[model samples]
Target: MQMNEEKDSPAARTVAALVARARAAQQVAEGYDQQRVDELVAAAGWAIMEPARNRALAELAVADTGIGNVDDKVRKNHRKTLGLLRDLQGARSVGVIHEDADKGITEIARPVGVVCAVTPSTNPAATPANKIINALKGSNAVIVAPSPKGWSTCAQLIAHIHAQFDRIGAPRDLVQCLPAPVDKASTHELMRQCDLVVATGSQANVRAAYTCGTPAFGVGAGNVASIVDETADAELAAERIVLSKTFDNATSCSSENSLVAVASAAEPLLAALCARGAWLLGAARKAELAQLMWPEGRLSPAVIGQSATRIAEKMAAREGAGRPEWQAIATARPSMLIVEEDDFGEDHPYSGEKLSPVIALYRVADFAQAADTVRQLYAYQGAGHSVGLHSARPERALALGLRLPVSRVILNQPHCIATGGSFDNGLPFSLSMGCGTWGGNNFSDNLNYRHYLNVTRVSQPIPEQVPSEREIFGSFFDKYGTA
Candidate 1:
């Protein structure tokens, strides 16, 4: 005999329905073998990577969210998908995945039930697509909660994935997202009911996930910084910095927010940055920008993810019709904005991340001071994220890597592109970056399909090797004599 179900509110009812469908989908997915799962993931990835469809998706993402650029987004989506496929080619994630005959143990990969991914406005399409691919690859169903601004783009992405799923006779409900009006109440309900949550937006959202009484993975805000030592090539450093800070209007959280230049190299760096079409703001202009961008001690969203010229127009103090110069810069659209500031402390608002084509300039006495200044900036916001260092001395670079709290130290590479994953580097390709405990995250690397799977260890009886106290502490005993 069945019992009567209790009446529920709209939010609870919606979440319950979605989770129920997802559970059913996951149960079917779990029956798939490793090869079948990989084939499905590959099919979805290829469909999304189709040249015409991928380009259209990029344009749609930018038009809907008003963040990032179409060209970059296209490149990001294709390349990230390709990289993930590369990483997944031979990996086993179903049934018995590993065996260690020497240790008489075997490891099995298991699905983590249903997962909920919280996506942000920037990279909305890419992030959701990647998360869906990952969840399905691990034989887990996923439900995304896209930012309100990104709902349309995410919906389109999900539909395309569903098209692929249908071709393979897979359940459509395997990938679900809160339909529209993605609000606080609905999102909270969804997170509460999901088996696991991959939260990758604002700090508040990440915190809420932690409190939802479910296992979660979250990333943090970025205030990434870089150092220019005396041995660095000012021209190359300036070129890379300007390109990175201005890429997609700096919507990437990994974009450089500050540049600590050794005193001897500061002038050359400024000249190099200027040569790259960066609008250098004098002291007065810098102060004006500060007041406008941070009117009440909080960064103004109006200037964020905007072109350089748009930013300058906001900083313009005159109340009358804007001067021709403002419009000229607007029409020309400088690559980025450069401002000089001596302060590197939290009190200095310029030292923090600005999600725009802006980079704060700081002068230091030497390389050691530069390293210390980088540490101080991370201590303010970016800790466990990453840092960029330019130097000819390997020892100096290694020393800073040892001293800083960051998980990655990009040496002579573009901070923005290199932060997540680069072909030149060994890190996994991902849009979601974990900040570790420094930024209230559990991981210090990129988030990928591997993060969504659970592992089971099977152990068999084996000869145990228990060492005696003297055997374990032989070196210490040899040094100090037995007590």
Candidate 2:
């Protein structure tokens, strides 16, 4: 269909109105000084990060989306926003930002105008708040287009943001969201009307953003696979992995879906994971779970982001009239489920992204085999995302980074928290991670304030310093005589 075919449609008209207001607000923001930008960002951050407000948003997010737990959602809202504020503190995104006397150039930062940020239901509150804060930091107004399941939470979040704007005398339109009845048409229209689009949900939305004829920044699908080598501290790795896998019920895209352990480390790691409340299911149970989790090759929405016990109970209910084995496991109250597998790919459904507290385990003969397994898994999915390595040998991480198609090779840390960003890590704090060209994305870095800004370099004439042919190609001529 033509882009203008739906111009008079309700969804398109709604988005067009939101974009128009956003553009007007952004024009006002464009004149903001650095201090004003920082103040506005701080206000937006505080709107979501305040404990009581965060708790409310978290509760509403869980209730609205029926995905993640409320308590962990609260933690994610607070910590992610706090971390982003920490990264953005004192950062200049206005006026003259950089200068180089030798190069006779000055760099200035400007906003990219209204931003259309498509957020996911998995992180309804935190993700949209992050985008709004970053957009404010760059003096750009933002219009959020939340998923259908996440619209209520996003609306409440926008209300909170509007209250903060009122307190600061900022325009309420500076931070807006698509009205009720959010749909693909409105999202496509917003992408078309906005100066830039930052989509961080399904691959379908990302693809739409790219094709919407707008400057877009979209993330890729996540199916993180981590390896534990022979030299790794198996206990520590297991502890970290379990923590990450169980956190928010594996709602984070960075959560490890598949784990590969060297044969020598497998048993010890398994024991440690068990100690950390990881219930290992038998092969028969694994088969049963595969069917329950992926009915007819599609992930069951009922189990996604559910606790281990909940999933076990569902499995038991599915086995009505048979033995109640899964019920017993459910009664034991495991934090997460572990299923051993030897395969990887579309044929092996367990080897892909399971958006719940379930992990697929594989045992390889050595580190080489482990890396190869990770590579093979990436070839099936999750290319240009991230891989984790829990090894004492630094060379293993280097090897993975050099050879793997992934973007980040996280070492000795929880994959979810580390892949996005953490207090101790150097990676930028963000909820959206660009997966580069390998994953069909334009950028390959964490989404941050830099992505919201348009930098202009003012160049002045410099003294002549052109290199002679002898100086420019001396090494090449010495290696092979130049004609």
Q: Which is the leading candidate under lDDT?
A: 2
Model 1's alpha-carbon lDDT is: 0.84
Which lDDT values do the candidates have, in the order given? Answer: 0.84, 0.91
lDDT of 2 by residue, 1-483 (tens): 664667777877788888888889889999988888888998898889888999999999888888989999998999899999999998889999999999999999989999999999999999999999999999999999999999999998889888988988899999999887888878888998899999999999999999999999999889999999999998899989988999899999899999999999999999999998889998888888888888889898988889998988888888442247788889989989999988877789888999999999999999889989988888888999999999999888999999998889999999998888899899988999989898899998999999999999999998989899999999999999997
Instruction: Report lDDT (Cα) of residue 84, candidate 1.
Output: 77
Error of 2 at 143 (Å): 0.4
Q: Could you tell me how far off, in angstroms, the CA of residue 36 lies in candidate 2 after the best superposition?
A: 0.8
Misplaced by over 4 Å in model 2 are 1-4, 320-323
Give the Å shift of residue 227 in candidate 2.
Answer: 0.7
Segments in model 1 whose C-alpha atoms lie over 4 Å from true places? 1-7, 316-332
lDDT of candidate 1 at residue 422, scale 0 to 100: 75
What is the alpha-carbon RMSD of candidate 2 to the true structure? 1.3
**Local error of candidate 2 at residue 388 (angstroms):** 0.4
